[model samples]
Target chain A: MARILIIDDEEQLRDLLKQMLSRDGHEVVTAFDGVDGMRVFNQFNPELVITDIIMPNKDGIEVITELLCRNPNVAIIAISGGRRAITAEFNLESAEMLGVKGILSKPFTRDQLREAVQHALGL
Target chain B: MAIKTKNIIDFKSEAGRILLTSMGALLLLMVSAVFLSSYLETQLGSFKEVVFLGLAMVIALGAQWFLLKTIQSPQVLSPEERVHTTNEKLRHILNSITRQVESALGIKNTAVGGIENPADMLAATLIQCVAIMSEQVQSLLSALQMGSNESLEEARQSFIPLIDKTAETITQYLHVSQNIDNQLRERINETQQLLLNLRRELATVPQNQQQDTSQLFACIRQMGDVLETHLLIDNVVKKQLEVVTHDTNDSAFTLITLMRDLSDQAGNLVRYITETISKINAMENGVDESVGYIVRIGHFIQDIPEKIQRDIQAIQSASGVIDSLSYLVDSIKEISFQTDILAVNAAIQAAHAGDAGLGFKIVADEVRKLAVNSNKAAEMIEAGLDTARHTIHEGLKFKFLEEVMQQMNEAAQMMDSVKKLQEGHEDMRQYYKTLFTVINQSNMKLAQDISEILGSIQYQDIVRQRIERMQAAMQRRNELLQEFAIQLDVTSGNNMDDFATALNAVLNGYLEEESYHGNSLNSSDDGDQPPKFELF
Candidate 1:
């Protein structure tokens, strides 16, 4: 399977995703937030990126702005929490605006993050 | 590039040769010209003054040719030389600027050592720097109008504004330097006030004799450009020496304070010692002394608490003593240095004292011996303090109040676990508050340390160390705004010629990726994952 990256602040969930992806024989890199997520994506040139919508410093919006400026070909899977937490949190519509191929919400089972990454990579 | 720059008149270099040649030949020609002209005017019976003047000019011209002519053809500057001359002037201007910058740098170095008195040194330094940097408007005219030979006219027209702009930078720095100096002076005065407060609380110091001496030295260190031009004054009046003196005094001040406080505490201990001696004497009296309250008092509940408090007080006093002694050693050294110089001055002044100076010499000798005794006693006190602290630390470190608190936390946690056995739930609340306070104190201390260390490092120095630190961070941030200002004035894009392009096609070159280390972000139009935390 092609390498995939997951960017999330939740350590527990990132760990779960890492385990599930490597089981599928794909190389997995995890980033804590949009800032490091973008940095890792640039350096590693990972075939696919799966990122969360909210982050501090350089947030998901900033990461998207910079990445598309360099290359438009890279595939992406976006996940969101919700506006119920804060109006700033990402929604499905903004993910569409950013050109994400797939979108998901939190409280999704292990099957969700894994299947999203697998589908985006065409594995 | 040519001897054209070397003119016969430029006595700045060959003054002696120019003076000798011009004075000798020119004077002879002029005198002969005047005599010939007057004689010819009388012969012509006024061929009018015009014709007589013409004949005088002719004779003067003939004599001047033989006398004033030189092998070098009286070198005047060539076109290239005009540029070099202008540049040379610019170099002098920059040199002056650099000297000021160096002085500022020197003062900055002094400030680097983390002393309470660096403010004074830095303020004086800024003043010197500003004087050097505060270029006049005339220098702007020179930097701008004085173009090199190749593009003299064009440079004169276009570069003047840049010179003006550079001048503006100097002016800005000057204003800032002055403001900073004022603020720094105020801060030093505040520090001096703090020092004065400590001294005042000390009560028994000889400040009347000593205060003026330090104040005078402080004034000398604060000398600016007027002092800097005299290279010796600027060079000798270093912040480093001031800082060393500062460090020595700081240690000594701390030493004196701690010693005084501990000595008072030692008096308290001496009272207990006297009591113990009285108890033994009472025992020897054998007057039914089985009910001696002193030994019994040590075992009582209230007495145990009092004894523990006393022990803690003793430890605090011991720590104070150690601190005081360290400072005492340092202060003594600095004062001795000051006194030595004063002594030398006095001795010189003593030579001129005549009979009246004998009494003053005696006073000086006494002062020196007093200084010696102060230094010796300070050393002994410091050694004693160090030994005492070592002994106290051995007994106290593990069993400090924190250990007692830890046991309380353990009992509280246990009690909370078995809350059903308790009559009230409010007991757990108190424990929680106590724990919170401790944690909050710990965090506050950490924050204080971070602020102190980072804030203490000068911002400009860090900026100079690596522009990339700020620039790189800014660059990353700039990408978000999507409008990073690329200075296009210099225009450093691929300057490929037509032939080069053709050659490149022949060689089949390919485009390369830009390296930005790990600073890469894939297009995540599909947002995923949770947000991360990063401090600003």
Candidate 2:
């Protein structure tokens, strides 16, 4: 099982991810904002970080940069949900540049997340 | 590959004749083309006589006649004839489908007058369902927006519980945060008062020490010593204050972030509710389309039961003629699938039997195409009927409707809970803000007091220490004055006592009467000073 950190401003979404991912036997930790996320990330150094793109006190990109700076070997997963559909989301190419190991659009199913994680880990 | 060569009407043979006719036309065409080419060449100065071209054309025509009866067009249906004929049959198919639609859906459909195409009829019916459902979906969405207690009859029944669960979660978090706010405010208020008390304790000294010779001198000496030590007290106080202020600031930041998070949670709930309702709509629409497709399937099955019985009689009558016709035995059997199939097959074979079968073959092809279409229509009708029966049987069951209505009601209840929870969360946010403002104002006042005290303490220490030092050195010299100005008691030690006392009296009076440069910090030793809660 992979250890995962979920970062989002929405607590319910955090809860939702926790329920879904943990039921698959993955260990999950949650943070509600970018700063707390960085703190928890540094402390836990979880195998994977699943973070929402929009946040305060340093957003997803900033967090990714800081995390990778601390440990370049770290793997991260960034996600963006349509706060509005047809609007620009977290750019996939940009996330790749920031060392994101995977990206997902939000409200995704378990199979999609699992498949992406498995592929990224080469499992 | 029908092997029947019986006068299965020779339309193809007639087509062969038509090809012979076309071959005759091509010969004429070739001759004209050569003549025209030679004429053009002569006009362009390339030829004087066209005799060579005329002689060549006569030879080609003679050759074309033999080509005619030989290969010619094999007795197949011409592409143009096939299209013209199929268009006529397709119109019939369209009419049949429209009738089926009429029988099944029972909607007020126009004659589909301009719509001769089968695809258009099908599309029109499907569009009918789509348009109807679109209106219903739009109304459902509007009803949801209003959150009318009774409007979303089915959905409200299902979604309410889920919304309630979400609302409960939000309320729990809000209460927790509210508790934290209350705790923090109390602690900060206490800290502020303590700071004020500390300043007062450090400001004054005891009153009795003002008049006492030894104690006054000792107190002044201690003040001189503490002037340096007081700088350390200032530094420690300043640092402790910084730590408190920093802690409060960090907590405030956390509180703000948490509040925004709560807002975000509320927003997420709203969005999720919208998405869920939309999904239900899409699902419901899908079910409705399935209903339409089922109706199409019913149209397909309606023909199967009646046509099969009619075909049984045709087969019996055709069997007798089959042996005499010899080659048409297979063709007759082919038509066993429908009344038209055998006719079409007979027509095709008759045409191939030279000129004799030509007329029959044309009829046979038309009848065969019609039979094929009818078979398809039968299948489609059967499928539609079965679909209608199965869908109605499965979907209209009491349990299914009950379950759907139950789920919808639960969803509605959940939505209500979410609304209430949002309102409660908003209140929580306001309470935090009010508490936050109070704590913030107190911290500011505390900061101001500490700042003023700290700023004044530095300057006060500098000036107070300088004066106390002067007072300490003068008193020590006064002890020296008493010793050096003592009257000579060598002649009679007892005799000089009066003189020493009188001089001491004179000195005490002068010292007591002297005025200081400014108002004293105390008229007497400063009241009720703490011995231990003193400077440090």
Candidate 3:
């Protein structure tokens, strides 16, 4: 099983993801935002990472770029719900350009989340 | 005749210009009157003539004063020119009133059109109306200044119409302004009603928010209760699994230890059994040889008595022959003794016959001596033969044969003991073979039971993982409800665009990974498709 890191500001979402992946016999870690995710990423060095595109303090695109810089082989899955003048789609596109391996929309089902995680990890 | 009168009159006017001739006539008349009066005074009295002259001079003086006064007065202007002057003043006043009225109308038009502020325009229109009324009053006062009475009446008539027209225009402007004011009031009332409805809606927002929060809290509490129950059950199951696994491992260890010990013992047992069987076989072979030798010894002992009986018969026969020889020798001696007596008498005689007797005696003596010696030999032979017969009559050889028979009975008894010992060794070999087979079957059954127990303990790990996932999913759902509440409050006063921006910013804060796809995310995506797996 792979070790996975879930980064999101929604505390509930982070907990849910951690539980789901851990159930599959993988080690799971959680972070509340992009900044916290980066800090934990260095400590955990998980095989896969799931992140959100629109964020405060640090956005998903920046996180993706920085994470890739640190470890090019790190797997990433980006999630978002579009908002405001900067759409979720637009932000997600930018994240894709920055090098994310997978993408999922907000409010995804457990199966979809697992698929995205598994695919990113090369499970 | 009238012509002749006219000609005489013309002759008279030609001789004197009328006023000059009249004055000259008056002077002439005065002079004549004076003369007449003098003559009358002379005829009547002097006072009458003097009074008439005085009256004539006073009348003349009054006529001259009237004529000079008429000529010296200011020149009279024409009635037409005075009417024109009064009409000009009225025109000027009406023109000013027209301009003021036009300005008021323009302000009212602006107010009605809603271009300018209505209140400000209304004030300006009122001022313009007041100015128009004041200028109309001034035009009425100027109309009284006409020169001729007729021209004064005409100016009054023209000025009244102009003043009335100015008043009418001012009234029309006032009516238009009033209509605009009514419309403005109605619009203000409608705006006030809209504000009141907005205030009532704002007041109900807090109640709605509180109700939603309460519902979310209840859901969270229920989740917490369920999670507690799950945890308790999980712990119990985990402990049971641990115990089972530990027991299985111990059993396997015990089975292995027992098998090893059994294997060593079985090896020892097999070696012992084989050695015992070999010794028993050797013993059985030895017993066969011993039993055969005992039978042969029994046969040899049975033959020993017969051989001893044969030896006893030969000794008895030898004794009988010795007795017969003694008897014959005794008989010969007796006959020889008689012959010797006779031969002695004869020998004396034969001594005489001795030569012949000598020859005969020699022969006889020799014969007699031989006869005596023969008698002596027969007696000795009979003595020896008697002793031999007596010794042979005793039981010395039979005693030897009886001792041989006694030894043969001891050998036969020893052979019977050897046969009993061989039968006992054969019984022990059969008992050892049955014991080895029973122990080998018991050891195999113990090894199989331990293997089954070890397999049951590995399934517990998967169950533990599933319980943990359920707890996490519930907790996350509770947190999402809280976020939705906060988002609702934030967007109540702002527009939809601003709310969208705020909500997106908050949600984006949690993102952790790299995004590799375009924003094709649909929140409402529903499908029956199963998940896909890949090897990265």
Q: Write the per-residue lDDT of candidate 3 for residues B190-297, one digit (tens) a residue.
A: 323323322332242344333434443233233223223223322332332233233323433443343343334333333433444455566566667667777777
Give the DockQ (2 decimals) of all models: 0.01, 0.02, 0.01
- Residues B1-536 of candidate 2: C-alpha lDDT, one tens digit per residue: 01122123345666777777787788789788979978888877555358778777788777776666454532344756544443433333223322322322221121111112232333233233323333433443354456542454443333333333433433443343333334334433433433332233223222332232333233223322222222222232233223323332333333233333323332333343444345435444544554555454455445544654555445434543433443343343444365675775587578678787787777787777777766666556556555655554554455446645765765565555555445445433333332233333323433443343333233223323322333333333334323322311122111322433443443343334322422222321432331111131
What tens-digit string does per-residue lDDT give for candidate 3 at A9-99? 8788788878888888989898888899899998998888888866667767667877876776789999887542234554454455445
Worst 10 residues of 3 chain B by lDDT: B512-521
Q: What TM-score number comes out for model 1?
A: 0.20
Q: How well is candidate 2 docked (DockQ)?
A: 0.02
Candidate numbers sorted by TM-score from highest down: 3, 1, 2
**Deviation (Å) of B488 in candidate 1:** 23
Task: List candidate 3 stretches off by more than 4 Å.
Answer: A1-123, B1-234, B269-307, B338-367, B379-536
Model 2, runs deviating above 4 Å: A82-90, B1-536
Report how closely model 3 matches the true complex, as a DockQ value.
0.01
> What are the Cα lDDT values of the candidates?
0.45, 0.47, 0.49
Sort the candidates on DockQ, descending order: 2, 3, 1
Candidate 2 overall lDDT versus native: 0.47
Question: Candidate 1 lDDT, tens digit per residue, B1-536?
Answer: 01123232344546655665777577667766776767667676765666666666776666556544542332344646544544443333233333433433344344322222333344334333322222221232233234222232332334334334433443443344344344435434433433343233223223342342343223222222112222221221222223223332332233233323322322322332233335334433432232233234324534545766887898888788778778877887678767766766776677689788887877777777766776677677667767777878977875556546754665565444344223122322222332233223323433343333222222222212222222232233223112101211122111212222332222221111101221112211223322121222
